[model samples]
Target chain A: EDKVVQSPLSLVVHEGDTVTLNCSYEVTNFRSLLWYKQEKKAPTFLFMLTSSGIEKKSGRLSSILDKKELSSILNITATQTGDSAIYLCAVEVLFGFGNEKLTFGTGTRLTIIP
Target chain B: EPEVTQTPSHQVTQMGQEVILRCVPISNHLYFYWYRQILGQKVEFLVSFYNNEISEKSEIFDDQFSVERPDGSNFTLKIRSTKLEDSAMYFCASSEAGGLAGMETQYFGPGTRLLVL
Candidate 1:
């Protein structure tokens, strides 16, 4: 079975602090790894990583994938209360017949304290 | 920006009742999918539709579940008979393509919260 595990299931950080969320996966025919932020309802896209050692960033948020280690990390710098949300990590795998499915992790619940 | 949209943000139905969840995927997109997330659980893929047919489906998608793209814009999932365990947040998503080498960015909808009593 394809599995994606995220570390530090829950975390609490103060405003202005930096935090790193971890995700590790064991999947066959791996195609891509994606990150999402879930606030109250649906999850919003964050970053998608395909190549190893390449970092994808947006403003204060950045993510990098390490294929050699079968792991990925999402870093948030200068965090604010608005950053509080459940961070989800999903791995996409090819299942033949030109089809793909996303296997997601349990997600990391991040709480930013003011 | 074009995003997927689902109807009946919340649906409450009795067990053994039938319900149809509707969705309108992003214009110009060719691929559509259905996913569900039970409370306090990970999101799970249910089915993937392309070219007006079902291209793939998970084991969770049984005979009781059916999907159809009846027209140019509307996609629907029909549950013949609901069960208590079927209560969940059903999400509709779409992408421009379906293969492994494509962009494969599946845009998701806000989801319909189904509660079976």
Candidate 2:
């Protein structure tokens, strides 16, 4: 079975602190890794990492994938209360004949204190 | 920015009852999907549809579950008999391109919370 594991299931930090969320996966025919932020309802797309070493960044948020280690890390710098949410990491894998599915991690719950 | 939309944000049904969950994927998207998330659990893929046919489905998408693109726009999932284990938030998503070469970002709906008693 394909599995994606996330570390530090829950975290609480004061504003302006930096935090790193980790995700590791074990799967076959890897296609890509995606990150999402879930606030109250649906999850919003954050980043997609397909290659190893190269980091994808958006403003204060950045992510890097390490294929050699079978893991990825999402880093948030100078976090604010608005950054509080569940961060989800999903690994996309090809099953057969062009079919693909995303296996997701349990997600890391981040709470930013003011 | 266009977004996927789903109806009946919440539904409560008794065991053995049939229910249909509706979704309207982004108009320009070609690939559609259905996923579910149990409370405090990971989001799980149920099925993926393309060209008006089922391209792929997961083990969790059993015989009781069916998907249809009734019209040119509306996509629906029908559960023949609801079970307590079926209680979860059903999310609808769509992507602009096929999954062959990656670069497809799935935009998800807010999701419908289903409770089977």
Candidate 3:
């Protein structure tokens, strides 16, 4: 079965600390890996990684994909209280000719302490 | 910035009743999808649509569910008969294209919370 697994289901860190969340997947027709941040509402797009070894960054957030390992990692630096949320990692799988659906991990809950 | 939009942020229905959830995807998007999350659970994919047809669907999307792009802008999901277990946060998402080479980002809307009694 196509599956996504995220480690350290929950974590608590003090403000300004750097955190790394992991996601591993095994799926057929692997397309791309994506990361999302979920607060009280729906998850918001963070980064999409396709090629391996190339890092995608947005301010304090960055992510990289390792196709050989079938995994990806999201790194958050200098975390703030506002950064506390559920970080979701998903893999896009193409089941048919041109259709894609994302299989998501259980999500890593990051709680930043003041 | 363009974003997907959903209506009736919250809905309540009795068991066995039908419910229709609506969404307006980004104007230029060619791929649309529906996903649901039961409280404290992972987001589960229900279906994906492209070229006005269902391209793929998950086992969770049984005969009880259907989707329609009734107009130029609206995409809807209908539940023939709601069950108490159907209560969840249904999210609507849209992407400009689908597949590995497209590099499309699926943007999600504020989900509609459905409560089945």
Candidate 4:
């Protein structure tokens, strides 16, 4: 079965501090990796990593995938109270030629204190 | 900027009662999915639908659960008999399937919180 694991299940940091969340996975057919931010209801997309050693970035947040290590890391720089939320990592797998599904990690809860 | 939309931001029902959650996926998307997250638990996939039929479903999607795209636009999930365990935040998502390989992103709805009491 495809599995995804995230480290540092919970983290607390003061405003303006930087934090990194980690995720690793094991899957039969690797397709892509996606990151999401969840505050209350549904999760919102953050970034999708398909190639190794490539970094994808958005304002105040960036993520890189290391295929060789079967892992990815999300970095939040100059964090603010608004950045406090659950970070989720999901691995998209193509079981066969066209079959696909996403296996998600438990997620890391981040709290930024002001 | 289109998004998936779900109805009944919150629903309260009793055990053994039937309930249906509705979703209106992105107007142009071809694939739809249903996921649920129990409080303090990771979100889980329940069912995936495409071309008006169910393409895949998880073990959690038993005989008590069913999905239908009854019309051209709305997608629905029906639970015949609700259990306490069925209480969770249910989300609906859509993606533009049949597109370039690995190029699609599944956009999610705000979700409907279901409470069974």
Candidate 5:
């Protein structure tokens, strides 16, 4: 079965701390890896990584894909209390007839303390 | 920024009852999708729709599930018969393109929580 596993299912960090969340997947016909920040109800778009080694960065968040190892990492620097939420990693793969689907991981719940 | 929107943030129903989840995808999006996440479980793909027809569906999308784009902007998912196991948070998503190999970003809606008793 296609699988996406996230490590350290839960993490607690203090403000100003830096943390890394890991995700690894084993699936057929990999297309891209996406990261999302799920706060109350929606899983807000974060970054989508398709190339290996080259990193995608936002204001304080960044992610990189490692196709060689079938893994990805999300890094959040200088975390704040508002960063407390479930970080999700979803792998997009091609389906039959040119369709696409996103296989999501259980997600890493991060709690940032002030 | 355009965002997908869903109705009935929460719903309560009895087993075997029918339920219809409503969604309004971003106006310019051409593709639509439905996903569900049971409590404490990972979000799962249910179906994808494009051009008023289903493009792809996962194994979980059985005979009990159906989708339709009644109007130009509204997409709907209907459950013929709800089951206790079917209670979950359903999310609607949309993308400007098919997200095939070109990598189109899919924007998701705030999900609707359903409970089957």
Candidate 6:
């Protein structure tokens, strides 16, 4: 079955610390990988990576896809209390005719204490 | 910036009762999708709609599930008969062009939490 797995299921770190979350997937027709942050409700988009070795960054959050290893990583630097949330990784697979679906990991619960 | 929107932040219904979840995607997006997260479980894809027809669906999207774009501005997911297992946070998403060639990203809604008892 197509699947996504995230490591370090949960983490706790002091504010200003840097953290890294991991995600790996085994699937067919992989098109891209995306990261999202979920606080109280739905997830907010973070980064979407398609090319290996190329990193996508926004503010303190950055992500990279290693297609050769079928894995990706998300890095949050200078974390703040507001950064505490469940970070999700999802793999987008294509089904022709511009159709697609996202297979998501259980997500890494990040707790940033101030 | 335009974002997807869903109605009824919360809903509680008896088992076997039908429920409809509503969404309004970005005006320019052409592809719409439905996803759900069961409490601590990962977010799961339920179905994807385009041109008013289902383009793809997961195994979990069974006979009890249906989708429609009732009007030009709204997309809906209907569960014919709710089961206890159906209680979950259902999220609505839309994308400009399914992001081929890394062109666009799927925009997610705030989600509607459904409870069936």
Highest lDDT: give the candidate number: 3
Q: Which residue segments of model 3 deviate by more than 4 Å?
A: none
**Residue B31 displacement (Å), model 4:** 0.7
- Cα lDDT of model 4 by residue, A23-114, tens digit: 99999888889999999878999998999999999999999999999999999999999999999998877653455667789999999999
Candidate 5 chain A, run of 10 with poorest lDDT:
A92-101
Candidate 2, residue B45: how far the Cα is off, in Å: 1.0
Instruction: List CA RMSD, all candidates.
Output: 1.0, 1.0, 0.9, 1.3, 1.1, 1.0
- The candidates' DockQ values read 0.73, 0.73, 0.78, 0.56, 0.72, 0.75
Clashes of each: 0, 0, 0, 0, 0, 0
Chain A (alone) TM-scores for all candidate structures: 0.98, 0.98, 0.98, 0.97, 0.98, 0.98
Q: After superposition, how far is residue A65 of candidate 5 from its true place, in Å?
A: 0.6
Give the per-residue lDDT of model 6 (tens digit) for B21-101.
999999999999999999999999999998889998999999999999999999999999999999999999999887464
Order of candidates by DockQ, top first? 3, 6, 1, 2, 5, 4
| CAPRI category for model 2 | medium
TM-score of 4: 0.96
In candidate 1 chain A, what residue range of length 10 has the lowest lDDT sum?
A92-101
Residue pairs clashing, model 1: none
Clashing pairs in 6: none
lDDT of 5 by residue, B37-105 (tens): 998888999999987789988899999999999989899999999999999999999988875536798
* lDDT of predicted model 5: 0.93
Candidate 5, A1-114: lDDT as tens digits:
789999879999999999999999999989899999999888999999989999999999999999999999999999999999999999998877557889999999999999
Tens-place lDDT digits, model 2, residues B1-117:
899999999999999999999999999888899999999899999999988899989999999999999998999999999999999999999988766855898889999999999
Candidate 3, B21: how far from true, in Å?
0.3
Considering summed lDDT, which 10 consecutive residues are worst modelled in model 1 chain B? B97-106
- Go through the candidates in order and give each one's C-alpha lDDT: 0.93, 0.94, 0.95, 0.90, 0.93, 0.93
If you assessed candidate 4 against the hidden native complex, which CAPRI class would it receive?
Answer: medium
Better of 1 and 4 by TM-score: 1
TM-score for each of the candidates: 0.97, 0.97, 0.98, 0.96, 0.97, 0.98
